[model samples]
Target: MRQIQAIALVLILGGLGYALWVLYSQPPLQLSAGQADHVSTQTAPLAPVKAATDVTLSAINTLPAPTTTADAPDLTPVSRLPEVNDEETYIPPISPSVAAPAYHGDLSDHQAYLVHQSAQITQLKQDYIAAVDKKVARLESLLEKGIRHQLPAEQLQEARDKIQGLRAMQAQLRHELAQ
Candidate 1:
């Protein structure tokens, strides 16, 4: 059944394609007699050649010469890919190894501000890391002594959970800062 359906579909498509080809591949539509007459009358028929003498060598010589630069159209550049030459030398670019720029001019306002903000951000990050480290150390110390100091089991567990949370937050912060 599927094979029959597939064959039917192929036949239908082929028939449609053939129909389209027959429609389009034929000559342009026929015009009315009046329209045909109007078109034929409008177009001047070429004169019958009596001899090749109409196109003489002297007539060719009398024709105006091709225009030079001044009269010609502005030669706009046509953007096309450069043709590769097999014989041309291909010098590999130098790797960015240590050559510093000669211009040591004063920094623009934006550049200076960027440098200042970067330093400020670095300092702020350092301050944050120091604070987190202190908190983590304090928590660890507390956890170590929680049982000896007669802290309740629930309280110790809560403290332990808090330390884990803080450590995770610290790790996340570090990851963000690294990025």
Candidate 2:
């Protein structure tokens, strides 16, 4: 019965696909007469080209030439220019007093602050490790309870995997703490 139904479904789908292909595969139909006329009337005619003649050439040549009189600046080559003296555009060095403020902080106090921040970071790592240990313990307990209660094997396996991952994370954190 299922085979008969499947064969009929395939035939129906094949007919539908063939119909769609026939509908879309052909070139578009010709436009209506009014649309054709509108398209033809909308096209613009090309402009005529101008012919070049001796008169046009002469007009182009008759433009005024540029003047080279005293009003124009000299165009000396760069290699021929004179060297500039340092004194002519001198910038004085900044005074030591003005630049020394940035280096004035106490290094020992900054060292102590950095040491305190390192202690805080270490404490946070330890706290995270403790949390992970708690999670591992809870997951282990759940796994044991699930086994005793005859829970689904998949659920028991998932609990086991989660506990293993949490223990691995704790081990990594402990290693980092040792560093």
Which candidate tops lDDT? 2
lDDT of each: 0.75, 0.77
Q: Please provide, for model 1 over 92-165, each residue's C-alpha lDDT reduced to its tens digit, 9 standing for 90 to 100.
A: 56987754333343557778667766766666666676688777787777777677878889999998898888
- TM-score for model 1? 0.32
TM per candidate: 0.32, 0.34
lDDT of 2 at 73: 85
Give the per-residue lDDT of model 2 (tens digit) for 1-179: 99999999999999999999999999987999999886786685745557655233346644657776776788898999977666543465586653212333457798766776777778778888989966787677767867987999999989988888888888888999987
Stretch of 10 with least lDDT, candidate 2: 97-106
Candidate 1 ranges with C-alpha deviation above 4 Å: 1-111
Number of clashes recorded per candidate: 0, 0
